[model samples]
Target: MIATSVEQLLNNLEGTVQVKADRVSVIDSRSLQLKVDSIVYNAVFAEGLVRDTARWLLWELGQQLGIYPSSIHEFYMAAGRGELPKSCTVPAINVRAMNFNTSRAVFRAANELSVGALIFEIARSEMGYTDQRPTEYVSSILGAAIKEGFRGPLFIQGDHFQVSAKGFAADPGAEVNAVKDLITESISAGFYNIDIDTSTLVDLSFDSLDDQQRNNYRVCADITRFVRQIEPEGITISLGGEIGEVGGHNSTVPELHAFMRGYNYKIGDLQG
Candidate 1:
C-alpha cells in the first residue's frame, strides 16, 4: 500500500518537483530575517563536530529572547519526516550529512511521517571545503533513499563546492565537467535536484554593495546555468543567492527590498 502511494505521489509532481524540508529543517525567522550572512559560519557544516554544533546552537538559543531552533539538523530524523515544507515557491530545508545508517533510518521515518525531500551535504573535513574531489559518501547517502523506495525529489545539493586553483587551471574544463558528471551520477544514484556552488563569498558587507551583489548574483547565474544545461530527470534546479542580510535586509525594509533583487528572490505582496 505504501509503495503504491509513493508511486502515485511521484506521478503527481510537475516542473522542478519540490519536496518540502518538512522534518529536515528547523525554521527560525530570526536567522532567516538577518541582514548579514552568518548561516555559513553559524550554520552547521558536514565536517564540524556534531555535538559541538548542537551545543553552539543551544548557546545561541540561550541568547534568544523567546525563539529557538528545534534541532540544529539531524540526518536520519530529518530525512524520515518527508513532509512538504509550507512554501508556495522554493521553500525547503536540508538535513545535511549523515552516515549511511543514519540516512537510511531517516528515510523510513520520513515515509512513515509523510515528508518530502531532505538535503545532504557530502564533503571532506577541510577548512576550505570543496566538492572538487570525488567521494563514495554521496553514493552511500543516496543508496539509503533508494532502499526506502523513495518517490520524492531527493536533492544532493553541491554545497559550498569549489575547485582548487591547480585543479581548475590544470584542466580549465575539468571542474565543470566533474560537477556535471556528478549531477548525473547523483541522479542515477537517486538524487532529485542539485545546487552548484562556485563562489568564495562567505560573509556579507554593508560597505561594498557592488561587491556583494557581484559576488552573489554571479554565483546564482553560474549555478542556474549549470543545471539548465545538465537536464536531469525529475529534478528541479535552483540557484541560492542572498546568503546574507535576512536581518531585515540592512535594518530597514526598503533597503532589504532593494538588496533582494541581487539575491535572486523578492519581497512579494503589497501589504504592510
Candidate 2:
C-alpha cells in the first residue's frame, strides 16, 4: 500500500500528461476533471492505457477508507423478482484498464451528476496484464468507490473463469485445480459473480448429444458445487455457463437442454 495521502494522490493527477490516442496532452487534474465531466470521457474511459493509470491513482486514494466490494447477485435476484424497475442496467466495468477513471466517473455521476451496479471485474488473463492479484483488484475498486464518496453497492466479479481443453487434456489435475484456485482466491477477494467457461471442454468425438456435452456441463456443475459450498448463506453468487466455444460452433437447443440435464444431475435441482 502506498503511504501517500488522498490529497497527494489526487494532486498527482495534475500536471501535463500525454494521451496516446490523439497525442492530446491533458493540462492538469482540473482540465482532466472537466474532460471527465464531459461525455468525451466515456470514450476516453474505454481506452486501456489511459484508464488503467487513472484508476490506479483513484484506487490508491480509495483504499484508505477500507471499503468492501459488494455482490452483483443481489441486484440480479432483485431484477428477477421484479423488485427493480424495468429498463435498468448496471454497468459492469472491466477494471484491468479503466478501473479508476470509470469508477470515479460512475460514483461522481450517481452522487453528484444524477447518473450511473458499477461492477468491477478482473478476468484470469487480465490478472496477468495488470499484475493484479484478486485481492488487489477488490481493494482497488472498493478504494476507488470510497474516494468518490459513492455509497452505492459495489460488485466485484471474476469474469471468464475458464479452462482450455488442450491444457486440461495435458494435465487434467492441473487444469481443474487452476480453476478451483481462482474460485477460492476470487471469493476471498469478495467476488460474487463468476462466469464459468468450460465451453472448450466439449467432446465432439462422441456420437450421442449428451456425450458431447458431458465434460462441459459436468465441469460446470462441479465448480458450481464448490462455489455453493463456500458461499455465504443468503448470498448466492450469480453463476453463468456457456454451451460452446465462441468461434468453434453454434449452440443448438438440444445441446442447451443436454447441458442443463447433465448439470442438474450433477449439481441437483436448480430450484431446490
Candidate 3:
C-alpha cells in the first residue's frame, strides 16, 4: 500500500500515473509507465509505509534543482565542439542511497540549490541493494526524482562496471557474460554513462605494459561495442575505461596508450 505522504506527494507532481506502493519485507523503488518529456518513468515504493518527512522536503527541494538531464557523451561533444563556456564546471553528486536517508539529502540539496547540469551516479561496488541487481539503481533515482517533483534532465550512470579478477579467473565466460548483461540492462534503464572498469584484470606481472592491459582494453572494447550497438538512436552513451586497479598502482601514460590502442583496434572505429 502506498504511504499517505508519498501518495499525496505524487498527487502534486505532474505526469505521475498509476503510482503504486506495496508493503513488503524489504526496500526498493521502481518506475511505472509514467511519461514525462517523452521519456517513461514509473514510481514504485518499497514495503512498509514510509512516513518520512523527507518526501515532502524532497518535493520542496526540487524547486531549486531544476532537472539537468544530460549524458556523458553530451559533455564530451560539447568539449569537442568547443561549445562549453570558458571556465565552465559541472558538479557530479553521488547519490549512494536507494530509498534511505542519504538519497533524501541529495534530493534536498539538488532541489534547493536549483543546480543545473548536475550528474547523479552510483558505483557498482557501492550499491546498497545488491540483491536487486544493478539496473534498479536507475529506477530508484527516477523514483526519488519524481518524489522531488523533478521533470528535467536525469542522467543515470553506471559507474565502475567492473570485473572481479577472482571471478573472471574461475569462470571467464560467466563473468564476461555478466558484464555484457549489465550493459544491456543499464542501457534499457536509460543509463547514459558507463565506466568500464577491467583494471582488476590488468596483468601487472606481464613484462610489457601493453600485455598487462590486454584484458582491460579488450573487455572495455567489447562492452563499448555492446553499448554502441544497443544504444537508443540519436544518443551516444559516455563510455570510460580504467587502466589501473584502484589501491594498487598509479596509472601511467604507457598503460593509457596500450589501452586506447587495443580498444580502438577492437571496436574498429570510434564514433564521436
Highest lDDT: give the candidate number: 2
Candidate lDDT scores, in order, read 0.40, 0.67, 0.62
Off by over 4 Å in 3: 1-70, 98-101, 128-135
Against the hidden reference, what TM-scores do the models get? 0.42, 0.70, 0.71
Question: What is the full ranking by TM-score, best candidate first?
Answer: 3, 2, 1
Error of 2 at 190 (Å): 1.3
What's model 2's TM-score? 0.70
lDDT of 2 by residue, 44-127 (tens): 232353344444433333333334455676667789999988988877668686555656666777777554456677778788
In the range 1-272, model 1's lDDT, one tens digit per residue, is 11123223323322212224321132443332231112222222223343233223322322232321121123333444755343512224333434445666776887797765455554222212332222334434434544454444444544444433355557746755765666565444333344444433423455655454554444445545655556454334433333443343443454334445554442123110
Q: Please give, for residues 26-140, the per-residue lDDT of candidate 3 as tens digits.
A: 1111222132211212223433233233222232233334433347777767877889886766666666644333444566677798855666766667663454344445545
Q: Which candidate order results from sorting by lDDT in descending order? A: 2, 3, 1
- Candidate 3 similarity to native, TM-score: 0.71
